[model samples]
Target: MSDALDQLKRHLAPIIRLQQIDGLLSWDQQTMMPPKATTARAEQMAALESLVHELFTSEKTAVLLAKCESALADAAPDSDEVRLVRVTRRDYDKETKIPATLVEELARHQALSHEVWVRARRENNFSLFAPALEKMFALTRQKAEYLGYRHHPYDALIDLYEPGMTYADVVALFDSLKPALIALVKNISEAERQFDDSCLQGDFPVEKQHAFTQEIVQALGYDLTRGRQDPAPHPFCSGFSRDDVRITTRFDPHLLVKALFASLHEAGHAMYDQGTPEAYEATPLAGGTSLGVHESQSRFWENMVGRSYAFCKWILPHLQKVFPDPFAHLNALELYQAINRVQPSFIRVEADEVTYNLHILLRFELETQLLEGTLSVMDLPDAWNAKMQEYLGITPPNDTLGCLQDIHWAGGLIGYFPTYTIGNLLSAQLREAMLHDIPNLETLIEQGEFSSILQWLRQHIHVYGRKFLPQELVILATGKPLSADPYLTYLQTKFKELYAL
Candidate 1:
């Protein structure tokens, strides 16, 4: 039995490494690859990804998977051997459904589509990217069809990123959040006092911002030896393995909060990767359980801690030292208020906690509509503006700020938007649980101590990886099923006090 399990692990290790190599290529395409190399990179990505899928879905993999499953049939359900087989089986079944040719096509298009998005966004012309996007969606729809689903085709797509999550689940979650969110937005708008965020906006050098952000992420427990940070159009974290995680942040030369918070956000992800046990490397359990759980860590660090008053106090001195002209004389409460000010924003990444989920809600609806063919790609810009007006009460003046803002669709991430909201909800739930276990969590933040918090995440969330489903991991970490109550309460309490509503 042990030998069968060992063979399964050994067989899967090279496949995992190949997948990581594919990921590394993706990271390079986004960060370091030259614009002119798009064609070559696309071919490279297609070949590598097609090979990975073929290897993963091979007859040998199937035989090993079956052998391991049979051998571990009577093992404890939670044992690593059993969980590894379970996760591998789930992945194997999904991968084997689609043809290698389809995999190659999707990979090639994703790479080409990303370059189109970059150029289109820079030129503020959605038309330049529209055809590629349409094709990507077409391929994605074909993918969902191949994967099969009981209800909505979107369910099959969403499950790839968030296991067991359905379109109905997202709809119900957002439906429950709408009334509360609307009330909060309304109350904040009509409040007697409004926060002044001018302190965060001013002349700040990019070099200084880079240096300061590095310090902040490192202080947040991201191991610099094992990880590094870079700049990207869209900030993201990529982990090839636990020891070689990397993060990227977008910088705004005039705004201090952009890079600072983005770094903390990506670092939260990097720390999670680094915290996973060394034994899980090159296995299905190496990274996050789901994109939603992964987002929880990033949002938790970026908002709950980095935007908290205590964090303001701890980071202010560092801020002043790095860029004194703006932060030199600012008080902790003032810094906190500036960073946490509630308002509708054009960019989702720069949005405050109070208005962040609204952005996700808009994307969720648009993506689902596009997937269902109810919405045409050409009319997507107008549809996006309508949703923005309806949800956030603001309209982006250009495609760059509107439909072209996110790179998800270009990368064929049709059902990925809802996970951001899921992350927000789980972050608050985790915070609530963390406070119960570590009463002085805020105090620790004020003193620049994040060991306990990271340790808590490591034990309860990071270690399990894909061994558990997202819902199960949430319940295990927070002692509750996934819920919107904590997130709504967190936003309501924080913003009401901030605005004195």
Candidate 2:
């Protein structure tokens, strides 16, 4: 039995490494790849993806998995060996359902499509990206059909990122969130007092922003010796291994919050990667349990910690030091109000916390419609604009700000948007639980002390890696199942106090 478990780990290691290499290539393509190399990169990615699919879904892998499962039949279900075999079985079943040819084509098209989306966004031309979007939805539909879902085609695709989650589950979650979010937006809009966030905008140079962001992330316990940050078209975190995590952010010279919060967001993700148990490396237990859980960590740091009044107090002096003109005159409370001001915005990533979930709701609805054939790619921009107006009381004037703002569709991430909201909800839940444990969490943040906070997360959440499912992990960490009530209460209390509603 021991030999069989060892053999299973050995069999899975190379496949896991190959997948990491694939992620590395993707990270490079987004950050450092030249414009003209898109075609070559597409081919390279396709070949690598095809080989990985073939190897991971091979007969030998199946034999080893079965052997390990049988050998561990009497072992405790929560033991690492049993969990490993269980996770591998789940992944193997899902991967083997799709043909390698489909995987290759999706990879090739994803690279090309991302380039098209980039150009279209820069040019503000949705027509240029429409064909690619159409093809992507088509391929995704085919992939979903191959995987076979009972209720909706999207269920299969979403499950690839969030195991055990279904389309119905997402719909129910969003349905519960919509009314509260809408009411919050309405109340804030009609509030007697409004905040002036001019303090967050000014002549912030790119170099200074980068340096400041590096300083901030490092202070938050993102280890520089094991990780680094770079600039990308969109901000993202890529972790190939515990020691090789990388983060990228897009800078706005006029807006300091854009880069600072983006850096915090990605660093949250990198810290999670860095904190995973070393024994899980290069195995199925490595990395995050799910994208939803992963998003919670990012949102935890980005909003729960980075956007707090306590964080403002700690960061103001540093901001004043780096970009002296605007922040030098700002007080901590004023800085907090500036950074946390509620506003509806065109860019989803730049949306205020009060309205961020509405953005996700829009994408969730559109993705569902696109999959169900109720929405066409050609009409997507109009649909997006309508939803923006309906949800946030504003409409985008162009496709770039409307449909082309996100890189998810071009990258074949149709079912990925909802995870952002899932992360947001869970972040609040985790914060609630953490505050109960460490009563001085806010004081620690104000003092720029994060090791205790990080250690708390490491002890509860990060240490498990993929050993537990997201639902299981959430309950274990928080002592309650995930509910929108905590998140809703959080937003209401914070915003009502800020706006004096």
Candidate 3:
């Protein structure tokens, strides 16, 4: 059994390395690659993806997996060796069902479509990006058919990001959350605006934002020795390995939250990557268990910690140092209230915590319609604006602030939006569990101390990597199944106090 496990690990190492290389390539494309290099980069990425698909789905890998399974038949089910084999086999079986040609095609189209989306978003022209989006969705539907689903075609797509999560499960979760969120949004909307965020609006320099972000992330235990931060059009985090994680955030010279909160969000992701167990390195188990679990960590840091009053108090001095004039008269509590102010927004990435999941829910509904062929790509812009108006009571005047806002659809990430809401729910759940264990957590944040918090996460969440599914992980860490009650309670308590509603 030991010999077979070693052989399986050796077989899987190169595949993992290739995937990491792909991630690096994607990071470069989004961050530093020259605009003219798009064509060559797309071709290169497609070729690499094709090779990876072939390698992973090959008969030789299947035989080795079978051998390992046979060898480990009597091993403890929860042992690392058994878990690795289980995850790898599941991935292999899924990959083998889809053709390598389809894999390369999707990669190539995603790269091209993403570039088109950037241009379309900047130009505020949906026509410019519509054909590419249409093609991507067509391919995605085909891919879903290849993957196979028991009930809905979208089920196959969602399972790719969140294993074992069905369309029915998501619908149930959303149904449970919608009334509470809508009521909360209505309550906050009716209340007079309590905080003036005018202080955060000023001529902030990009350099200062970068420096301050770096400082805060380092203090939060993101190892600058093993990772670095860069700028991107859309902020993201990529991990090539546990030792080499990279995060990117965009800067808005006129807004403080753009870079600040984005930095914390991406840093949360980087911390998760950097904290993966060394024993799982160079294997499928070395990264996050799912996109939902991954988003939970980012939201945990970005909102539960970064948006808290204690965090504002702790960072006030550094913020004053960064932009002395704007923050000169601003106290920590004022800044905290301003940052947490709830209002409907056009851009999903910039939405407030209270309204953020509404944006996701809007996308979730539209994407499901798109997958089901009830919504045409040509009509997406209208549908998006309608949803925005219906949900938030404000319609985007243009496509840029509407359907063209997000990069997910362009990148063929149809089923990824729901995870943001799932993550938000889980973040509050995790925080509830953490608070029970660490009652002085708010105090620690106020004092700019995060080592204890990071350590607690490492022990409870980060170290396991992909060893368990997201539900299992939540149960293990929080001693309960996934729920929206904790998140709803947290939101109501926080916002009712903030808005004095």
**Best of the candidates, lDDT:** 2
TM-score of 2: 0.99
Worst 10 residues of 3 by lDDT: 190-199
Per-residue lDDT for 1-501 in model 3, tens only? Answer: 988888888988998899999989888999888998899989999999999998888888988899999999999988888999999988998998898889999999988888999999999999999999989989999999999999998899889999999899889888998898899999998897667777799888889888888988999999989999998878889999999999999999999778999999999999999999999999988999999989999999999999999999999998888788788889998999889888898988888988898898899999999888999989999999899999999999999889998888888999999899998999999999999999999999999989999999999999999999888999999999999999999999999999988
Model 3 alpha-carbon drift over 4 Å, by segment: none
Clashing pairs in 2: none
Off by over 4 Å in 1: none
lDDT for each candidate structure: 0.92, 0.93, 0.91
Q: Candidate 2 overall Cα lDDT vs. reference?
A: 0.93
Could you give the C-alpha RMSD of every candidate to the true structure, in order shown? 0.8, 0.8, 0.9
Instruction: Give per-model TM-scores.
Output: 0.99, 0.99, 0.99
Q: Per-residue lDDT tens digits of candidate 1, residues 111-196? A: 99999999999999999999999999999999999999999998999999999999999899999998899889998999889888
* Cα error, candidate 3, residue 48 (Å): 0.5
